[model samples]
Target: MAAVDAAADLLLTAARLPDRDGLVDIAVVGDRIASNGPASVAARGAIDLGGRLVTPGLVESHIHLDKALLSDRVSTTAGTLEEAIRVTAQAKRSFTVDDVRGRARRVLDMAVRNGTTAVRSHVEVDPGVGLTGLEALLPVREEYAPALDLQLCAFAQEGIIRAPGTEGLLRRALQMGADLIGGCPYTDSDPIGHIRTVFALATAFGVDADFHVDFSDEPLHMHVREIADQTVRLGWQGRVVVGHVTELAAIPPFEQDTVVAELAAAGVAVVCLPATDLYLMGRGDDINIRRGLAPIRRLLAAGVPVALASNNIRNPFTPVGTADLALLTFLVAVAAHMGSPADLRALVDTITVHPARMLRLPDYGLVPGCRADLVVWECARAEDIPATLPARTLVLKRGRVTVEAEHRVVERWR
Candidate 1:
């Protein structure tokens, strides 16, 4: 390595860039991938990745910063979604800024260390807590600014219509630097009113809308249809996100395909929060226990972007999580019965490119001139990467090395 040039900060030699052939060299110039040039490049430093797979950094589309990591705080004695909500609501009443920050910090450390370069977290904003969670989290966004891109949605978990004064708090959060407006229609006294209020606020703030709609095992609650209608009516196409439309799984395939097509035409992206849903939903029925996921295959077939996410980590809603994207992918693969190699390869996109597309992240791929937010995996093929969940990896943010893990072993038998 020669004395580093000011313009070119680093050179990566023999790093197996994904979607490209033949162990090429990559250059990073001032936080951007410069070009795929000769291996003998002039830069300050060089890292020979030893022909490992270099991939775009992971993206977490739907996660909760405020209500995460609360598995021990409350017990889901009944083990139901309503019970989870009750417990979480009770816990939020005692949240101090430090408490919220501390919990959120743990989630961030867990995510960034595992190759997630971008996270869109939903922070609760309602009269009960009244912007305290967002107040605690805004600084965190600044704290991790150098390492990852964090976007906060002013989420109303308690339902805007049911929780009076919540609509006002959501507006305040958006004005106070929240990036998106969030809603949960099912929790509302008026599901339609809930959707209307949240979308109106999102439009008023010129921000995006992310909603938790139709999150039931029954097919009766079809708020997702109204959400799509509202998205088009507001001219908010491609700017709307709907999460946890699990009821689509129960609807007939023909009906599900029709709705998925409408969602696709409306340009609304869907997020499947498997971990929390798996734990919270399907606990009521004994016969024909539902998988309780969005119709992912049908959605993809209908040209809708459905991204997978770790919705909650070790909380009442979800009791187990390692905060690893690979683990999330693996669970979804098994739960959704995606067994084929092509299906597994498609699973990779739910955590990576698909979320990037949903979030519309600029400079967010492995191409030259993109941001150097990338991960280098120990595995050789992308399909094998998910099975090797949380493998030994190197993480780079803006062309700088941020996290590097050689390996881990709990028990080895040889």
Candidate 2:
């Protein structure tokens, strides 16, 4: 291998990129990737990946950190979305700053260990929880800055209009350092009004808007159309995201196509929460239960950026989670019927490139000049990521190694 002119801070040798064939060397200068080629580069440190697959670090497009890991404290027999919200609300009544920080920290640790380099977490910002969630997460964000880029979305899990003073609280949260604003339209008395207020805040603050919209087994509240209209009307294209649109699956194919077209035209990205959607939806059916999920393949075919995300972890909403984006990809590959090599590779994108685009992350990728946030998978092929759920051999954030794992198997009988 030929040597580059300038020395690198770190050099990764014999690594396989997802799109490129054969092994290459990645040279890192400061926090950016200086070059990637089949050449040796002098560096202060080096790692021989032995042909392991390297990809841009996974991104969690949408998550709830404030209300995560509450299944033990809250009991839910009905296993419905409403019940989860109600029980979590009751739990929030007893929440303190330390409590929120402790739970959120645990989840963050899990995420980083799983090779997630960027996250967009939605913290509930209603009258019930006040600003406790925001206050706790602000410091956690700073603490995890070296390993993960955490974007805090001031979310209204409860109704915005029905729960008075929520709008003001959201404002204060944004003023204090929230990166974005979010809303739950279906949970409000005036769902459209809630969307309007959320957009208003987003535009006023020059931030993005993420909504938990149309999460049901039926097409009861397809507020996504209104959201798309406002996105186009307010010129917020490419700045809006809608999650858990399982209602799109319940509607007719033609109706779904129409809404999907609108979403594509309006540049609104969609996030499919397979864990929560599959768990909470189709609870009424005795037999032939539906697979409650958004039209992920259709959305992707129509050129809309679709992401698979972990909406909740170990709570009434999901009941179980590992904060692993690869697990979500595996769930969707079966639940959404995406098994082709192309589809499987695309599913990998949902956790890496697609969500990064949705989050509007700057300088993100494995190419030269991009940030050096990368993950080396044990497998050599991208398609095997979802099929095998490969272990992360090494996780890097901004040229700094954050997490490293080793797996060994010894056959005593042999």
Candidate 3:
């Protein structure tokens, strides 16, 4: 008789999964969800979830690893986005590979501990540094490849398409396996020309395009429309994502709806970065304090696919952040007016399924025949996420327990 397989890696029972309503047990056998059902689901050994909320691990759609590393050395007293950029430019000159790796690893570790399983970070490719930073991060990126599901966007922070020699650098990064081509059109000296050039490069390289566009409090900075128009013209629908659409909220109400409709029709996804926005934009104003977050609720109400991100973690613009979606949820709920229970549940889509679609991640969700990149957030209900932002009671990456939060109470004696 054949021997029964005895070494199952992980099993989680009595979990209140987020995607659906109910308490079910999840089994992870070999790098994917083996099966999910009642506690009776067969496994080598099962972990008692104790009726905690379980959801797919969080996905941070837009972040800058280069700047995330430089955060400690710089501090922005005034807290403006422009100031943060200036600080980063200065700090970038002194960063070594080891320095970048060490700081970035801290953020990633924090993210993993907080149950973020996937991320798409925009790593800048400077003219002098070339792709050294990106190249240095390759092994580390691959090290967490299965667990964290990382995708690197070789971003031309100085405008790849508009700046000389940057186009070649962008192409080389792509050849070196940069997952996406990123741009900062609003910050580019020639914004329109930069957009035109990057769009062509994305086409030529056959990679996805994610741009930091219209990150302005000014209503007149409607580069979002131009991006949508170009995306439609190139038939790059669903392949393009616009991060930080701050202008969408500042625009006229009627025009905002029109822009959303156009973007939705063009198959563009909008990413909102609450952490950095709340810190950077709308500062130095006595009245009319701007929240700086994108119009997430408005976009969702209009049926436009939207996602939330922790853009800057401990970066110059903002000196504090935990790589936790729960915090993002709370801040976004307040800023976007997502007050209802149903609204909160729907918000999970922005962090999970919405970003999966944005990054074209395959089989990312907890279902049959999917990668078992899952986290068991130990909370009772979806709304409970905000109140008790517990670490993943159980974490399975590619169906293996990479890291499990130990439950030990430390008693302090005075």
Candidate 4:
């Protein structure tokens, strides 16, 4: 909380803001940007960025920190989703507070170093793990308060209706500062009931809803449309987010359009977990090929807000992740084929601008009235950002420098 009290009069000189008023300097005062124009106006302190691309601090809209970095601890011969679930559930029983805290800390450090300023992490909230995940993460959230704003979602990865007391556990998690109610309807016996329970808890606690819906290659059990309808009926528009709706890719084109339009109408946000879905789905289909990812272009075309993120970091669900969102953005370009120059602009929005809107982050962006959560990358143009991962980057949170990495090349032979 002291992050707000220590704000100083800082100025970022010669930084570029894309699609706005070209290259300009930005000024910050007390955690909020006061102005963004000429640097000669002066401040208490100033750092000359020298034409670096300055973007809003990255938003990690979907991530699971609880099961992060556990691939080494748990062995899996088959990289199927069921194996992932079983191994992770079995591992949770032995999760001491220190075990969870240490692994989460690594993920947090990776995210911060990669320019992540805000993150929404899903913590398991079933009877098997109880509130241990939530309990362990709360302090870590406070520990990284200055560098990263961590939001915890009480995820019922096991089930809700079938698990009996799972709903109560989610409620308890929310009462303990969990920001949203999370659900995986595919894991539940009564998927509809599971969705309703998540919405019910979110409604009761006046929080938001995020569900991991229809994460399969088969499109028969899709529920995104129903969830969109429920959003409208419950008046939870603009407050609900659904992650990994991969079945949207498998649905008929017309139905996909309908669902996209419905989601847009209800003001629901969609998150695509490319790594996990592309890895887990289509395991049973050997004769046929399939693309396991949500339709990012179609959703954006329909005006339904969407974001891409590093969903899992080195876990059973996804064994390879660095908590670096630039990799996610790069994957979006390669996997979704949005690599055109015009499309590249949209790709930048997927990580910086769109996610800020999806997560409703306050004081975000490089605007005068927004927060000073910004990333100064060693790049000239924003379109060239995704070609590689973050090289030398400087990340700021609430007007304070949290990460600063630099690389220099010298000609010694000459």
RMSD of each: 2.5, 1.1, 3.1, 3.4
| Candidate that would win on lDDT | 2
Kindly report which residue stretches of model 1 are placed more than 4 angstroms away from their true locations once superposed. Answer: 1-7, 37-39, 408-414
Which ranges of candidate 4 are over 4 A from the true structure? 1-8, 409-414
lDDT of 1 by residue, 67-110 (tens): 88888777778878888889889999998888999999999999
Q: Which residues of candidate 2, in runs, are more than 4 Å off?
A: 1-4
What TM-score would candidate 4 get against the native?
0.95
Clashing pairs in 4: 363-371
lDDT of 3: 0.78
Give the per-residue Cα lDDT of candidate 2 at 116.
99
Could you tell me which residue pairs clash in candidate 3? 31-398, 31-399, 32-372, 53-379
The CA lDDT at 208 in model 4 is: 88
Best by TM-score: 2
lDDT comparing candidate 4 with the true structure: 0.85
Against the reference, the lDDT scores of all candidates come to 0.86, 0.94, 0.78, 0.85
- Give the worst 10-residue stretch by lDDT in candidate 4: 1-10
TM-score of each: 0.95, 0.99, 0.93, 0.95
